[model samples]
Target chain A: MENNKIKIEFLSYSENEYIARGFVSVFASTFNPSVSWLSDVKTAVSEGVTNCIVHAYPNEIGKIILELEVNNNYLHINIYDFGVGIDNVNKAIEPFYTSKPNEERSGMGFTIMQSFMDDVKIESALNKGTSIFMCKKLLNSVEE
Target chain B: MDIKYTVSNNNLTVFVYGELDECSASQAKNILDRIINDNLNSQKVIFNLSGISFMDSTGIGLLIGRYKKLIKHNVPSYIAGATPATEKVIKLCGLYNIMPKY
Candidate 1:
């Protein structure tokens, strides 16, 4: 509900690239983070968004909602989807584990999120849905 | 990310271009795994990373995995063309101590 919070929803399709690029850039610039940090954030968001497209819906159709909130010290990115939830959250974070090996997935989505973000948390059940909450802190700037 | 592999004589050359973040790390691993399994008898494996701009901890994992596989086959591993960013990560992970970097 704050002025710094941003919310957008889009279909979980390959064309989400444009949507992702726009949202990530706005959030990165708003926080005055370095370009390198922005790139990492963008890459992590891409991985999470792509996972929603490829894993969440499967053969069905669905939508993904991205919520971003930025304050002076931290930036939060939340991705949500209403699809078949992950059955094994632990195994899913393994470096080389992939449920869709036939699709050539490397199963590194969650790993990327963990490595790039300051904090990552996943909540879901078998048939409910999945939500990924990530937060990154800005270290350089302070309130004037 | 674009991945290309070339085998000549007894060396396996892997050229990884673009970014090798967590998203593309597994794809790189799978491609390398396939190449190594089918050609386990090679004398050496060379990773050409001149075109790589950015790499994270996952990149380190991939390199170490391949290095181990090559070692088991008695094949030495070599790397070249690492950008500053890539070099910093490699050093942070202490990979240069494990294998030769060019």
Candidate 2:
């Protein structure tokens, strides 16, 4: 059972609270991260998910898939969106960088994700899509 | 997020509450800008973070931007009421060196 992984996908709509509920419910039990750590992770997750809704499709609709896997005391979360892909991931991570500055975005979404998570991996291609793969290690959990 | 503005003895204070992340940062920045512009001659501007429950990197950005604006006019900036977790993030970001957290 340790080898098996669980994945949850939700539609990228403003009304969908399932993404947050699903993520917190699963990670709360699996990692038992500190409250501060949990809040950081949750905020980062919410920011990424919100970006998918605001940036990915523009006027069109899309889906966001959150895949979680536990491996060797580390939890991996992959948030994937098949919408308009990022042209430059580096620029996106830079502080005060925002493509939608007109919308009053602080442009620190990627930076917060990088700052809070242990590891952050982003993969994207123009018009293809963007995927963020993040990992956090459980201080108390041991390898299976 | 909840934002409150108050004036105490010639000083303008802004209290930031709740989570201030990428989404709500602009509001904070804009409000601060307005206060600073309105009180350009005021010497002290205090940001009370007592009510803030969660804050991320965006919070740091918001604070830094305000610091830059206030510094241009020789106004002193102060921070107070940061929780341990919030304080940790502020320290880790080296903002304490720039804007001392009281």
Chain B TM-score (each prediction, in order): 0.91, 0.92
Candidate 2 docking classification: incorrect
> What is candidate 1's CAPRI-style docking category based on DockQ?
incorrect
Model 2, residue A7: displacement in angstroms? Answer: 4.6
| TM-score for each predicted model, relative to the true structure | 0.65, 0.74
Q: In candidate 1, what are the lDDT values of residues A4-97, reduced to their tens digit?
A: 8888898877557446756888867855777667766776687677777767888876889999887657788999989888898888777657
lDDT of 2 by residue, B11-102 (tens): 87889998776556767777778878988777688889999987765677678788888899998888989987678667656777877875
The prediction achieving the highest DockQ against the true structure is 2
Model 1, B1-102: lDDT tens per residue? 788888998778888997675457778888889888887888888889988865655576678778877898788888887876567556545678777785
Q: What's the interface RMS deviation of candidate 1? A: 6.1
Model 1 chain A lowest lDDT segment of ten:
A135-144
In model 1, state the lDDT of residue B67.
Answer: 85
What is model 1's C-alpha RMSD? 5.2
lDDT value, residue B54 of candidate 2: 70
